[model samples]
Target: MGEPSVDNMFSTASNKPHSRRKRMLSNVYSKSHIMANEALKAQISTIIYDRFLPYLASTFDDTPPTTTTEQPQTQPGGGGVFNICALLSATTMDIVTGYIFGLNASSNLIDNREELAWFLDLYNSRRSFNFWPQEFPRFTAFVERWMPGYRLSPKWVDEANGEIEKWTADMCERADAQVSSAGAVGGEEKAECVPVVYQQLWKALSKEAKGEEESGGTLSQQLRMSLASEVLDHLAAGFDTSGITLTYIVHELSQHPDIQSRLQKELLTLSPRLVPSSAPAAIPDPKAVDALPVLHAVIWETLRLHSAIPGPQPRFTPAQGCRLGPEEKSYYVPGGVRVSASAGLLHLNEEVYERASEWRPERWLDMDRLDVEKKKDMESRWFWAFGSGGRMCIGSHLAVYQMKYIVAALYSNYSTTIVDDTDIEQSDAYTAPPKSDKLMIKLIKAYT
Candidate 1:
């Protein structure tokens, strides 16, 4: 979105720069690192128990409604009817920011509806104005210079971006300050509150600057922009995609009570369990939660059927022209041409996935029941939720980590039924959210 030097890992085009940035934070985002991080575990516990569950509880009456087979068409008086899409967006924002900036310095949007509404309005406002700048940058730049009286996108888009950038910069400063204070005070108790992502990136950048200075090179002036831009991209994408996926997870589970019941049984199998009274004292081990097959199946199915970033991820052809299509019908394509592949299309290949349009978590569960080659193709070749290869999503592990725990903690205590799903279809966009941006559902306490 800015200068190449200040852009995030995803925006950095050259392999060298992108690989350099990725190396700085790759260790922390690794599946092993995320699963074992005590800081992350503490952050998840605080967000899920202290913030998320309490907020859900506040939505219902003092006494939880008794479980029943008959689903209600509607309910009134704080009847646990909540716009789940909005709630999920807020929940994921808190979780993602907590890991980025530490639980002590993060936005607790789950506890404040007004702040959540304001932030979402500011964020989603920019989606409509992305076409010209993203698709046709040259034309947008030409128009801006030649047609001074007219504007392709409104002025407020700039204001919105400024506000977001300012907010990110503030978080960076807060994190830096926390690190300094931690060192000065010999902070021991707050070990679990470390701003893992920010600290790793800042230290890595500083180290590079120090090495450059020793070699008689000038110090970089854009360090602040680099750090802020990278983390802002992380925060935005992390929260949005996971939130959208989780919303659909809840929607699908609600639609299928049989599936919901089965998921709850699996969640309850954890030792400490994520039930209300047990939390704050203990949260299930993330590894244990991750091992649950039913939970894994449900999450995987939702990700496939309702992928968050379902649109084309564009890439440029290499300078040395390349061949395209199957070897039998290969054709030459000239260098520098833009090419794109879509996950939505790939996942819908009937050969790869039978009855591909349906949401069947059983397919994942039945992988062993299929032939060897068929199973391999589905898992490694066709399933492209977080993409593949070196430039694939770096935060994929963290996203799945938070989602599984969040879902486990949620279904452990309550069961949800759809209250209103009008226009619940996913929007057709690069990063899709629900079209109406709302999915109302009612939560009932699960008492066994």
Candidate 2:
């Protein structure tokens, strides 16, 4: 929320400016585009097969701790015990960055633990200080400037932010080079490595900025920063939210092995099963994976129960004001008043979702069995994970696409059991992550 510029769609408060910016690249993140983009498909396949799976496989060599004390022991086979939450974060980071900047230019976090740990440390450490700056920007600024002895946010926060900005700016530069170059990188692998989101926005902005040099528009500098800001927002939100959801999916599935088994069976039905092979794994068609009801239910239920952004999303009332509450209790709200909703509370409505406190994926699967009104309520009315209406998440389709594929690929081969869930509770932040930021799990091969 401590945004440096309001040019990014997320930070742009006014409807007109946000909508205009959203219009430029909304189609790229559309469901149809995400499902059918060959470049995206290739990018997913490369990440899952070449990076994520291999990293999981490398965990086989690890020796898990056996006791709370000094003694350590090896399991019968080997130690595939590792922090899957961190791995999921890394994978999502890679996927989002690849989609934004191209596979060739993206972070290799999945295969590079040192960098992953470093980046995660920098990113996650800033969470505790967010409240001061995000919720009280003016007071935070005043304290930092007038009362330097009592800085609201630490100096290192700025350093961490600077590093992240520089990192994103570097990717933007690489993407710009990719755009300005005469021809594409020559190779079968790099052929499908096009920066889909970046290219679309870059082309649109360039056309919009055309012939502005005569007017002293300074289009180049402004355009570069604007693009970087937007894409950086996209990358951060895309990775963090999806990673949190996927981690919970694995946790819930591990606790309910029967459901996990059912999911695995469905995953096996894919023509090219997402299993490890001597040859590159044939990543299943995302459409096929999407159609699996149980898989869909798992994802939906996880999203419902463990909404990444469970905090208030504030919106101002219309200038003309509007009615509030049920018909019996309806009252007129004053114009220009700030109002908000929380997905966490909305999803827990017992009337909308029976056993609302439970993690029952079957609730999503059996929605059609409910009464007409109940089914409607369950389907879309109560589902606010991605928010609703004009300003809803533009990356929802892409998020679902990557998550489905990642889940399908992982569960198709290994069965997960929680190694430790000491502090696995969801945090109370605006964008909630696991309290401990760790979910260690042991992955056993479903077959051998």
Candidate 3:
């Protein structure tokens, strides 16, 4: 098919009430929805920090070496094989699932080779094929089934959805089993559960299934499946974005020794270091961590420089078209036209930023330097890290929290200097990572 016509691309079914599912999906893109999601995310994040990190640290033997002075010996000729993308992807997914299903049902893919491989295969394929389905959902769904090479045909989408449904159902079944076993024994021994979210979801489904509420009567099997689909979307989105962001942060820190040193100094100010084992079992209180300005700024700068999903955030022009640009000069984009603005492009706009192309954290430090009008512009339209308006990232707050902890933990315990800086440039994928698999950094332990 030729490029979709402007009319075809932006066509809204005239006079038809928008479908509720469509409205729900649209809400996912809104700012209010994102803020509400952050609260759920924070609860899940605590589990990740308290339980998941320890498990990963132990599995990877990521313990800092005993001595600060000595460098850990490397295997010769085996440089740059560290697949930072895989590490970050697995880490993010594990954390996200922990939040979604509770710790009991969360994935342990970080150390589980087979699971990790399956996940990456699915994830990579989905990312590569997303644009087609998103752009022409109805047509793509039809053609994909019969088409070859573009393997995300209708059959593939069905299979993917089925797998996700089965996975979520299994979690629900397991929770039910635990609840039943506990009930049998006078309900005295509560099973070590994942989180309350899954249990709550299970109860809701059970009530709906029993036809206990008339308003929920229409929400039966298909509805449950749709909810499952949304959950999967959330998990997939949370994982990939966080993973890619962390990969870039690591690359940047490896390149900047002085910045790394200063970050380490800030981390040391935490009463007990932010090291994996140093903290209490739970993550430090979100409020307390959020208060650290330096930690917040470092994460913010890294996010600004290397937004994980840098592609255009697609939004269709409203019917009757809309005005954009400085003078509100009407461009007359046809209704149903797919138009978007990229954070990658916006973040690097030379007008709003000095040395826009340079990776300077100091730009973030001096907000006052810019003239008041420029600062207003920057505040209003410049920063698009988490995105702006209603459709921003839902788990952005939790992502920030995870990134800070990861950065703090790494820098506070070890000093990193780049081993192969040339290969550190990002690839051209939707979720970019270092072009070279290895982000070889020599780590020197830090002592306060």
The C-alpha TM-scores of every prediction are 0.92, 0.91, 0.73
Which digits, one per residue and each the tens of the lDDT, describe model 3 over residues 204-295? Answer: 54464574542222345554554455456667677877877777777777777777777777776775555656544334444556666666
**In model 3, where do residues sit more than 4 Å from their true spots?**
1-82, 144-169, 172-219, 276-283, 328-330, 366-376, 421-424, 435-438
Which candidate should be chosen as best, given lDDT against the real structure? 2
TM-score of 2: 0.91
Model 3 pairs in collision:
10-336, 29-391, 30-390, 31-390, 80-438, 102-195, 103-194, 104-194, 144-153, 145-154
Q: Each candidate: how many clashes?
A: 0, 0, 10
The TM-score, computed over Cα atoms with residue i paired to residue i, of candidate 1 is 0.92
TM-score comparison, 2 vs 3, better candidate = 2
lDDT of each: 0.82, 0.83, 0.57
lDDT tens string, model 2, 1-448? 2344436898787898889899998999988889888888888888888888877776786555432211122245647777787789988999999998888777888777667778888899988888986677678778877986887678899889888888888888787777555443333346456888887788777767793322222236777888888999999999999999999999999999999999998887887887777356466777888889999999999999999999688787888999987799989998899888899999999988889999999987866677898877887889899999977999999999999989988898799999888889999898899999888788888865
Ranking by lDDT: 2, 1, 3
Cα lDDT of candidate 2 equals 0.83
Judged by TM-score, which candidate is best?
Answer: 1
Tens digits of per-residue lDDT for model 1, 1-448: 3444366798787889899999999998999999999888888887888878887776665444343211121356647777777678888988888888887777878876666777788888887788897778779989988999799999999789888777777787777676555441354646556888887777788778675322122225587678888899999999999999999999999999999999988887898988668834588888998999999999999999999999688777789989987799989988889888888888998998899999999889967899999998888788888998887899999999999988987799889998889988988787888888788888888864
Model 3 residue 260 distance off true place after TM-score fit, in angstroms? 0.4
